[model samples]
Target chain A: MVDVRYETAFTLYPYARSADQDADSPARHPVVIVGGGPVGMGMALELGLKDVPCVVLDDHDGVGVGSRAICFAKRTLEICDRMGAADPMVDLGVVWNVGRVFRDERQIYDFNLLPEEGHKRPAFINLQQPYFEKFLVERIRAAQAEGAPIEIRGKNRVLSTESYDDHVALEIDTPEGPYKIEADYLVACDGARSAVRSMLGHDFTGRVFEDNFLICDVKMTADFPTERWFWFDPPFNRGQSVLLHKQPDDIWRIDFQLGWDIDRKAVVQPEYYMPKVQAMLGEGVEFEPEWVSVYTFQCMSMDEYRHGRVFFAGDSAHQVSPFGARGCNGGIQDVDNLGWKLAAVIKGEAGERLLDTYQEERKHGADENILNSSRTTDFMTPKTEIAKLFRESVLDLVEHTDAMRPLVNSGRLSLPCVYDGSSLNGADDAILPQRTRVGATLADAPTDQGWLIDRIGGRFQLFTVNTDFKPEGLNLDLVDVIVAPDDLITERYLGAAEQAVYLIRPDQVIAARWVNPTAADVTAALNTAMGG
Target chain B: MEKLFTANIDDADGFYAELLAAHEGLSEAESYALNARLVLLLSNVVGDRAVLTRAFELAKQAG
Candidate 1:
C-alpha cells in the first residue's frame, strides 16, 4: 500500500463526499473512462473538445505520487498543444536536445536532436509526471467550468464491466456506495496492472529484462547541464549503467542499474542508494532524497486493444521499457488516435467500423515502441559476454569518430509513429518528397497564423498548396479547406509543382496526396478514409 | 564464385595486426565507416558483379 502520510508536493484533490447517482436510475453516458490518470484525462479532454460527453472514474484523489516519466518528446508536446495544455507544459519543462554517453570516465559522443528549428515546439522537455497529469486535469476542469460535458469522479473504482453489443454496463464502487452506469463505449486506460485487462484475462506477451534499476529523485542545487547524461560501468557504480535527468524545481532523477536478483524493496531505501549517489555527486554536494523506487524493465503488449464496445489504451494496451521514454509518450499518441474516432462514432459522424482502425493503427505504434525500447535495453544491458564485447567495441569506437555517432544508442528518444500501412491511408499518385509522403505525419512549417499545425488541427483538412481548387456538391462540413500561400509551405509540400493537394486526417496524418486532384478524386479518397 | 582472394597475402598475421592497429585510435563509428569505404574500394577493384555477390553471400554465411 502507498503511504498516505506522505505529503504530496502538488495539490491532492479531495475525494468527493457524495456518490454519482442517476436521477432516472442507472445513468447513461456517451463514453465512460475507467481510469482518471493522464491518459484517461487526455481522452476526456480530447473528446470534450469535440463536444462529446465522458465520465472518468479513478480510485485515486491525487496526481502521480513520484516524479515519473520525466521525458516528454516533441510529438507529445504537439499533441498537448492541440489539447490546450502544451504552452504551460513547455514553459514549466526543462527543454533539452543534447544527449551525452560515457564509458567509465571517457565520453563517447554527444548528439543534437534538432539542429535546425522551423517547428513550434522544442525537441524534448523534462517535466515530472505529476505535473503532466495536473495539467491535463486542469484542462478538463477548465472545459467543465465552461459547461463542457466532462465529469471526473475521484475515489470511484470500477468493480466490473459487462460488455453488450451496443453499450457497456459498468458496476462502479465509490466511497459512498456502489452504483451501476451504462456507457455507449467503455475505455480502459487504467494502467500497466490493469484491472479490466486482468478481468478479461488478456495475455500480455513479451520479454522481461533481467536487470533492475533503482530510481532516485533528489532535490539539490547542482550545476549539471540540462542535457541527458548516461554512463556505462562507471567507477562509482561498477559494472552498472547510470542515467541522469534534470526535472523541474531543482529535482534530478538518477537511475542506477542494480543487476537482477536483489530485494527490490530493500534497494529502494536511502541506506542502499545514498552511498552510491554520494560517490558520484561527492559528499560535499548537499542534497535531499525526494523519492526512490526500484523497477525492472518489460516490453510487452496485448494482441488486440479493442474488445467489442470496450477499448484499452496506454499501459492497459501495451508497455515498454522506460529507456526510450516511449511508455507515456506513446500512450499520449494512443489518446490522439482513439479520441477523434470515438468522438466521431459518438456524434454519429462515422460508422462503428471506424473504431476498429484504432486497434489496427495503435497496435502498429505499440509494436514500434516495443521493438525500439527492447533494442535500446539490450544495448544498455547486454545479456552475454559476446554482447558486452560488441557494446564495448561500439562505445570505444564512438569516442573519436564523427561517423560512428549514429552507432551510439543511449536512447533513441521518442518520435511520432506514422501510420504507414494503415487502412485509412488513401492512394498517393502525386510525385512528392519523402517528408510529405501520404502515410507520414504532417510536417510543420512556419505560416502567417502562428504555425502549420495550429491551422490544420482537430479536423479533416483539405490542404492545398499554391493552388485554388474547391470541392463542389459534396458535404464540406466534415473537411476544412486550408490554403497555404507561404513559399516555405509550397517548397516543403508542393516542391517545384505549381499546385498540390493533400487530405489530412484529424490527427494530422496525411491520408492521400494529388498533383491536381478533382472533386471526384478527393470524394473517393475521403470515403475510403472514413472507412465507408 | 571461387575463393578469389584466398589467404593471398603472405604476411596475414602482420596484415591483421596492422588492420587492428588502424582501428585502435578510431571511434567505433569511424572504424565501421572505414570498413565500409574499404569494402566499396575493394569491390570496385574486383570490378565483377558475380564476384561481389559471391563475396557478400560468403561473408553473410560466415557471419
Candidate 2:
C-alpha cells in the first residue's frame, strides 16, 4: 500500500505582474525568496508575521520526493512555533530523544537528550521533510488568509540572477513565459543545487566524503523502540555502518554505508538490498519498500552567506552529511537568524548595517555545523590506517568502559549555535545560572500563565524575575517588559541575586542581563542589539 | 552474565591495514612480544579479572 501522506502536492499561487507594473516594467518587492522549500517558506512566514511582504518562487509544486530530513531539533521546532507551524508539526511527528549506538552485535551505549522537565518542546522530533514543508506552507497560507501579504508561486523557477549595490534582480522561467522580478534583498533558499547561487558564480567550498550510503524508507510493522540506532559493523551489513530511525506512518529510514568499491548502480536495486534487509530483520518478517536512493555526502558551504544585496540560506548556503540531522535543521535556524534582522531593516527600525550581524552570527553557526559534521564523518569512515586503529580502539574501549562512551561519534546531533562573541550581545552585569546566559538562546522555564517562551513571543523583551522594579522613564515600546514572579524563573534567571533583568532580541536570544538595571542601561543594550 | 562478543570493526580492510602497519619492521619474535604487551595493556584497562578471563577463554575457543 502506498502512503498518500508522503505525496504532498502544494497548492500553486498564480504568477502575474502586479497591477502597478506594466508589460514593459518589472514588479518590484521588498523581498524575493527563490525557493519554495522549508527554508524559503519559513523565511516568508517570518517576514509576513512581521508585516513584510515577499514572493516565494519554486520549480516544483510539492514537498520533497522522499522522506528526507527526518530529525527536527528542539530549537528548530521552537523557531517553527514562532513562525506559526510548530503545533501541527509536533502533533503529527514522533517526539523522541533517546539514541542507541552498537558495535557488531552488542549495544554499547544509549543517550537520553532531555532528562529535565519544564520545557515547551522536546529534544527532537522525527518527521519527514515533506510533512515539514507541508506544515510550513499551511502556516503561510493561514497567515495569508488573515491578510499577511505572502505569496508562493509554484512551477516558477529562477533562470538567472544579478546583484546590484541597492537591490538584486532575477530572470524567471514560468509556464506562462519569462518575466523579471527585482527585490531590495533576494534570498536563495533553493536546495543544494541552487540555480541562484550558480548564476551568481559563488563558490561553495568544503570537503567531500568519499563513501556512498544507501538510504531506504520502508513501511514496516515492528516493535522497535523510537530511538536512533547506529551500528558500526552490524552482522547483517558487515563492514559497513547502518543507521535505523523510525518515522511517522510506521515507516523506518535505514541507511547503509556503501564503500567506494561497490557498484553504485547495483546497490540500490531491491534484488540486492532485499537480502540485506532480510538479514537485518530476520527471515520471516514482512515489510514493503517505500523509497530508495544512494547518496554521497559533502560538508560544504559558501564562504560568505551574504554577498551584496543577495543572501543564501539552507542547503543552498551549506550542506552537511546526513549523519547529523544538521542540514535542514541548520537551515531553519538560518532563516530564524535572518528573519528578524531583515524585518527590522525593512521597517526602518534598524540600520542597514544591522543586516551584517546575520552573516556574523549564522556564518559562525554554519562553520560549527561543518566542523562537527566533518569530525563525525572522519570518525565514521576512517580514511587512514591510524584513524582506523583509534576508531576501533575507542569502540572496543566503549564496550567495556563508560569513559570511552562519549568519544563515540554517531552524528554528534544538532544544537543551537551560541553567538558568544557576536557584536549584537550586551555584557552581563550579574552572574546568573549557566543555563541562562548572554549569547545563548533563552532557556525555557515554566510560569503561572504559560511557559516563559509563550509570554516572550517574537519581540524585544526585558524579563525581570520576581522583582517588582518598574521602569521610571524610558521608551517602553522598544522592549516588552515581563515581570516573571515564578520561582522557577527566579532560579533560572536570578540565581543568587534577588532581582535580575534581561534584554532579549526578537529572535529570543538573550542580549544582556543586569542585577539592578536603570532605564539607561536597558536602552543602551537595546540600541546595541539593534546595531546602533 | 558473560559479555557477548560482537563484530566491532566495520571495515576489515582498514583494520587489517592498521594491524599490518603496527608490525611493519618487527621480527616474528618481537611481534609476538608486541601482542603480549598489547594484551597486558588492554587487560589493565579492562580492569575486571573475571571478564578478562572470560575473553581469553573465548578467544581460545574460537581458535
Candidate 3:
C-alpha cells in the first residue's frame, strides 16, 4: 500500500495546510497538470490568470537542453504574448519571412510566408526551445509571484494516478518522497511516452518514418542567405536531404537526413555531421558543432483528448512530426483552447458541456497538423524509390510553375492550421472557415487569411443583418452583427458564403451561423458557446 | 444572405459599403486600433441595460 502522508514529488506551489481541512482534504489545487514542458507550462499560466490553482509535476531536472522545435508559428507567439513572453521572445529570436530550399549546394527554390501579415503576428520566428522554455518559465514564475496558485515542481515524477467519481488520486514519486494528492482534474502535458495517457489505456496510433535524421546545431561559415534553407539532394551526400535553419544566439540547427541503416547506438560527433557541412562549404568557412542528436520523425495521434475529467495537452495528447512546426505550436494551441474553457467551466460561467468541445476542436487540429507535417515530411524525404524519383523531378522543375512553386517549396511549413469541424464552429463547416478555404467562408469579412470574429465584428458579436427581429428581445451585450455590404465578400470566398449572421466565438471561431438567423438560432448559439 | 457584421473601421465606409477593404494589408497597429473602435460601437449597440444584464448574468454564472 502507498503511504499517504509523505509528499515527495516536486511541489512548487504551497499545499493546503493541515489546519485547513481533515488530513486528506488538504488545499493543493482543483487542477493538477502533469509535465512541465511548454504546453504544461502554458496551461499553468492560463490557470494562474484565471485564479484556478494548479500544480505542475515533472521528473526531469530542468528543461531539455539542445535545440528542438526551432520554428514558432504566429499563433504560438500570440499565446506567448498573452503570457507576456512574446516581447522578450521577439528580441531573442530571428523573425524569418523567407525560406530557401536546396538540392546539394544548388539552391533549387525559395518562398515567402508573410502573406501581407494578414493576421496578428508574423508567420514564424525561429528560436531555440531551451531558451524559449527559459522565457516561459519566467512568465510562469511571475504569475506565481502575483499570488496565482501555480507552481512548478521539478524532479517530481508521476508514477500513476487513480480517478474516481469526483477527483483523481495521484501517486507521484517526489525527489523527497512519495505522496498521495487528489485533484478535481488532472491534465497530462507529458510527452509521447505519457504515463498518464498509458494508464488511462488511451492508444497513440500512427505512422513512424523509417528515415533517420541527425539534428545538429553548428556555427555557419558559408555565405548562405539568412533564410531557412533546405537541400533535397545535397551533393555531399548522395540521396540525402539537408535542412539548415538559423537559431537564436547565432547558432544554426541543421537536420541531415541519414537513412534508417545508421546505427542508433552510434555516438553523435562533429565528424559524423561535419562532412555534410564541409560538403556544402567548398572553401572559406569555419564552423564548430555545438550539439547533435539523431532523431526519427513520427506522426502519431491520440484516440481522444479528454477522458472524463482527465485532459491531455501537447505531446501527451498527440505527436506530430517536427515538420511544419506543428509539434510544439499545436500543443500551445491546445493550451489556449483548454485554458479559457477550463476557466469558464471551473467558474461555472460555461456549462460542463463545453468541456466536450475540447476534444472536437483540438483533435481536429492535431489530426490536421499530423496530416500537414506528414505530407511535408513526405515531400522532403520520400520512402519509396519511385516516390523519391518523383520528388526529385518536382524539385528539378521548381524554377517553373507558380502553382508548383509552393508545392515543392512546401508552404506547408508555417501555414496556419484550420479546424475543419468543431462544435465551437457555428453553421460554417469549420471554425474560422473564412480563413480555411477547404469549404465555405465567413459572411462579412473578406481577407485571404480569413476574418477574426472579435476584430472586424463587434465584441460579443450578434452576426445578424436582420436587426429586425429581437423577437424575445434577447440582450445584445457583447454582441455584433455581420452583413455582406456587397459582392466583395461573396466573390473572394468564391461561393459557400450563403447564410444569415453567425455569432463568432471570442477566439474568432464562428460560434454559430444561421441561415435565417431567427432569435432562437442566435440565442441557441450563444447558449451553446457560453452555456447559458 | 443578410449578413450581420460590423464594418471594419479601416474601411472607407466605416460601417456600410458595397466594397470590402483588403483589411489584411493593414499593419497590426492599425487593425487593433480599429478593433477598439468597433468594440465601443458594439458596446453602445448592446445598450446600458443589456450590458448590465449580461454582465450580471455572467458574474452570477461565474460565481
For residues A1-532, write the lDDT of model 2, one tens digit per residue. 1112234444445455443233577778999999888899999999999999998887766676788889999889889887778998899899767888888898888878774677898878899888898888888889999999998876677777889998888877766677787899999998788888899999988888899999888888977788888889999888889998999999999999988788889988999998888788778888888888899989888888899888899999999997778999999999989999999999999998898888899999988888778777877898765566567877776666454455677776688888988999887864777667888898787776787777775878777765665566654423233444456676678787767788888888999888888888888888999997
When summed lDDT is taken over every stretch of 10 residues in candidate 3 chain A, the lowest stretch is A13-22
- Write down the DockQ of candidate 1: 0.04
On a 0 to 100 scale, what is the lDDT of residue A6 in model 3?
Answer: 27
User: Against the unseen true structure, what C-alpha lDDT does each candidate score?
Assistant: 0.80, 0.81, 0.66
Candidate 2, position A424, lDDT: 96
TM-score of 2: 0.87
Q: How far off is residue B48 in model 2, in Å?
A: 18
Task: Tell me the tens digit of each residue's lDDT in model 3 across A1-532.
Answer: 2123323223333332222223455344689999877788888887887788888877764567677778887767766765677777778888776878777567755667555533445667888877777787788788778888887766667777887767888876754566667789889999888989888788889999988888878876555667877777678767777777888766888787888889765738655667777666565578888778888878888888988889999998889878778888889888877887887788787887788888887887888788677767766666554445445655554443233353462426544455555555544432223543321223234344344322332124554442444536776643333435354444333235454455655444456654455677677767766644
Task: Write the residue-wise lDDT of candidate 1 on A1-532 in tens digits.
Answer: 1124334446545557433464457788899988877798899999988899998887777785798888998888899998889988999999777878777877766766664557888877999988999998888788888888888787778788888897888887766777888999889999888988888778888899999999999998978888888899898788889998899999999999989888988887778888889988877888999989899989889899999999999999999999889999999999999999998887888998999999999999999898778777877887654456556765664553343344455676688777887888887865676678887888887776678888776888788765677778766533223444455677678776667788888888888988888899889888878877
Q: Point to the candidate with the largest DockQ.
A: 2
True contacts kept of 1: 0.00
TM-score of each: 0.87, 0.87, 0.75
CA deviation > 4 Å runs, candidate 3:
A1-28, A221-224, A399-403, A409-411, A414-416, A427-433, A436-502, A513-521, B1-63
lDDT of 1: 0.80
Chain A TM-score of model 2 comes to 0.94
